[model samples]
Target: MTLHEDACRVLKEWRAPDGAQARLRDTYLAHLDAYGDGVWRSRREGHITASALVADPARRRVLLTLHPKVGLWLQTGGHCEPGDATLADAALREAVEESGIAGLELLPEPVWLDRHDVRCGGPDAWSVHFDVEYLAVAAPDAAERISAESLDLRWFPYDALPDRTDDAVRALVARAAAALG
Candidate 1:
């Protein structure tokens, strides 16, 4: 199946944790139905983005990047690429690319969903990212290097996230820890 088909299949099978997430899932499906290119970043209406929280249980921390554009500490994620075969592949690719960590054990099922506005969706000045969030377990000695996409990359304790961190990231981390347990 194509990547867009894979997204539809994955979202259809996913069980949302709450009414809010269910609503977002439905909205994303609707967007996909209306635009064949909805999964790609080129879609101006909005697009499906994949994110992964990198958790190191040994360190009791999660890796976060200070996004250069958003200027907030956020999880590893971004717009899907042509090379991504599945939503999970996209999330894992983002995690590895942004964190400079290799061999991450990614959980295929999504742990959370977030919708946020951004500037990258062309000149319309109105674009939303239908973010599908996943979790990955990092090796005990995993090292992180900052990518150009981020101003800085750091591992923050689960209990002590950085100031101005989005609640979405915190929620993703909690959901990830629960999934890891």
Candidate 2:
């Protein structure tokens, strides 16, 4: 099956934790229903993006990258690529590419959904990203290297995320920790 079809099925079956998430889930489903190209970056209204929050198996800490453009300490995630077979695959690919940490295992399901406007790929490139967020567990001895996508990559304690992070990331961390326990 196509990745787009898988995404539609995933969102349709996802159990949103709150009314807010349910609404977003529905919106995502509707977007897909409305545009055959909904999952691609060319979708101006918004495009489906996939991302993952990487944490140690113990869940005590999370790996965050200092985004080159946004300059924010955030999780490893980004736009879906044609090579991706599913949203989860896209997120895993991005996490591995950005963190340089291989063999990371992704949670079977997504943990969060976030929609936000971005000024990525220079000035002319702008759009809202309907992000499907998942949690990935890194082995205890996993070594990380920084890629061109990030200025720095490091792990922060669950309760002590850096001040540069926003609520979306904080909420993802909280959800990821609970999922781990």
Candidate 3:
């Protein structure tokens, strides 16, 4: 199969029950195809980013952020902005900037690629269809610091994740647990 077909195939497997996943995959695939075109290319393109599954070794817990929007606990990440040449760098940068944790390490080499839409400044501002979400490991000491993007950040054991957390966040926790084993 061609690269696009291959990517689409994988996306099919990564598919979730929600229609959102299909939208994300379709949008990002288009971005990938139009990567070299001018002008609107940069703006329309989606970029990669990392989300740190920070763990507190001492406490045997994982660190999570309570996002300002969506209001559920999740991993920190944002767009891979103009300065980031690669998605991996963007992932790491956003993790640090949003999570207030330094020394994060991209782990499992970002085993997944997915897309999501980020609505900006209410309905009127620019909306971003982010070709995003890389998975990573933090330097174990990350639980000590928390950034402003989160209303609260803290460590929670795998078995003790808050009930209010989103399903996607829970899926990440499951993935992390499997990787560590």
The 0-to-1 C-alpha lDDT of every candidate, in the order given, reads 0.91, 0.92, 0.58
Per-residue lDDT, model 2, residue 42, is 74
lDDT of 2: 0.92
List, residue by residue over 95-173, the lDDT tens digit for candidate 1: 9999999999998899998999888854556778999998988999998889988999999999899997988888888
Ten consecutive residues with minimal summed lDDT in candidate 2? 119-128
Please provide, for model 3 over 125-181, each residue's C-alpha lDDT reduced to its tens digit, 9 standing for 90 to 100. 444544445555566545456676778887789768998786667766766666565
Query: TM-scores of all models?
Result: 0.95, 0.96, 0.68
Q: Cα RMSD for candidate 3?
A: 5.7
Better of 1 and 3 by TM-score: 1
Error of 3 at 176 (Å): 1.5
Residue 142, model 2: lDDT of: 93
Ranking by TM-score: 2, 1, 3
Among these predicted structures, which one has the highest lDDT? 2
Whole-model lDDT, model 3 = 0.58
* lDDT digits (tens) for residues 1-181 of candidate 2: 8988999999998999999999999989988999888998877768999999999956499999998788789999998999999999999999999999999999889999998889755598778899999998999999999999899999999999999988999999999888887
TM-score of 3: 0.68
Q: What TM value does model 2 have?
A: 0.96
